[model samples]
Target: MFFKRGMLVTQAILLNMVQLLTVLLLAPLVKGWINRSNALFQSRRGPSVWQPYYDIFKLLRKDSVIPEQASWIFTFAPYIYFTVPLVVALLIPVLTTFPLFMAFMGDMLGGGFILSLGGFFLVLAALDTGSAFCGLGSSRARFVSFMAEPVLMLVFFTVSLVAQSTIPYIVNQAFAGPALILAPSHILVVLAFFLVVLAEIGRIPVDNPATHQEPSMIDEGRTMEHSGRHLGLLRWGADMKLFVLLTIWLNVLVTPWGLVGSAAPLAVALAITALLGKMAVAAFLIAFIEGCFAKLRLLRIAEYLGAAFVISLLAVITYTMGI
Candidate 1:
């Protein structure tokens, strides 16, 4: 019995790791597709789907540069930064639950709360580097996180209200449960989660993903001193971050097929396909939104996030009031 249990745990862990890396590998393709779409819109030639993979291989082969004045933390930050989000990306149900992950942070409410921990460390690690860009990015990330968590919690709560369970799988099951139609709270939560997605991912009207704006770029502002392998990890980590969020939304609203791990090979294959398809759609939607909106002033970030908070809070209140 002990050996069988150990084997099961090992299999689960290895499967999670593989899935995490697979998401990393797919990240660049997702970016490439968006770039291709945007390029077509601009009437410019776009790069190929293989571009991101090539870039990663090239970056990995190159030697890394570490500034002499930089603290050890700055040098080490990229590895931890990369791996944590990868773990997180796999922890959430993308196509299916891995079982062990849900065993640990199983509750959607708890999982949402746990993201703040990652946000906290990401910002702190950036600050530890002591670079102005890093500091600025970290600061903005902090603010966005503040707005994102409550919205996520409220969203989960709304689901829980209908399902009577905060476990993601349970809430997912709630989709077909009582109150299956669009509830007011559900609508508010969805809107709030969508906005939170933008802010959390450093999208427009909150922060620009592709900007060197001295004071405004949230994700890139950090790691100004990182180079080569470190930069690769950070970049790769970012893709995982985007993928994870996409997975959460996909599982929450779209297909909750496997809240527990799939048994048959065919089922797992189908689940993987469903995940990739959803991820592609999400990436396009996010890219579309980013292309349509101008970056907001740092001061106006509050207005955007404030609205998300209002929607989220209203979701929670509506859920609690059973309205």
Candidate 2:
């Protein structure tokens, strides 16, 4: 019996490792797909879909140049930025619904906090460089985060009301139920969360991922001083963050089908395929929206986020009304 238990533990550990690697490796492909889709909408051919991988590889092979005045925080921040999302990925139900290693660490609320912690570190790192661009970017990033975080929390709380717990897997399982999907409250929550994802990933009307123009940049400004491996890590981390957020939006809140409820191999394989298909659909939709909308001015972002908050609040109110 002890040997059998050990074998089960080993299998779980292997599965967890595979899931982590999958998230890390697949992140860039999602970004690439989004970029490619946007290019197609513009009637122009873009860079290869595998361009991100090659870019990272080139960056890794080069040496990073640091400013003379930069502190240790500036140097170490990229690794921290990269690691936090990887940790969150483990906690979320990316590949399988079954609880894996580190499953007990926390639930959906805890996952949000972990993500916030990483964002905080990123802000500090941006400040550590003392560059005017980084400072401006950091300030704007914080402003958006300050307004968006509460709405995000509210969305989570609204969803939790239905699941009766904050655990992501349980919430996903709850969302998979036919009754919850059709609930007016749940539908509102999903819409609100979709808006949040746009802001969180620095998408259109919030921030542009492809621009270096100072007037319209938030995330890019923060990384202006980083080069070589540091830049590689930062870019890679950004991609992973996007992938993780989309996975949560796709598998947890939006389309919660085909997620493995058991440890069966075939079920897990099918779940992964379904997850990719959903991601592709999501990527195309997001790219189309991005191509259609212009980036909102910094002050206007407040109103955008305000609308999200109001929508999330309506979700809670709707739930209370039991409609």
Which parts of model 1 have CA positions greater than 4 angstroms off?
1-18, 97-102, 109-119, 176-181, 257-261
Once superposed on the true structure, which residue ranges of model 2 sit more than 4 Å away at CA? 264-266
Task: Write one digit per residue (lDDT tens) for candidate 2, span 1-323.
Answer: 99999989988987888778878998999999999999999998998889999999899899999998888988888998899889998888898877787876888778878877777888888888888988999899999888989999999999889878777887888888898898888888888888988998899989988887976689788888999999999989989988989998888898887787776777777877887788889999999998899999899999999999999999999999876
lDDT of 1 by residue, 1-323 (tens): 99999977777776676566667777777767766666665677878867777777777777887666666676666676676656566446554554445445556655555555555656666777677788887877777677667667767767677667766555565664445547777777777878987787777778776678676677777757677887777777766666667666777655555443654556656777777776677777776776788888877878887888888888778877978
In model 2, the number of clashes is: 0
In terms of lDDT, the poorest run of 10 residues in model 1 is 95-104
RMSD of each: 3.0, 1.1
lDDT value, residue 81 of candidate 2? 88
Judging by TM-score against the true structure, name the best candidate: 2
Candidate 2: pairs in clash: none
Model 1 root mean square deviation, Cα atoms: 3.0
lDDT of 2 at 292: 93
What TM-score fits each model? 0.85, 0.97
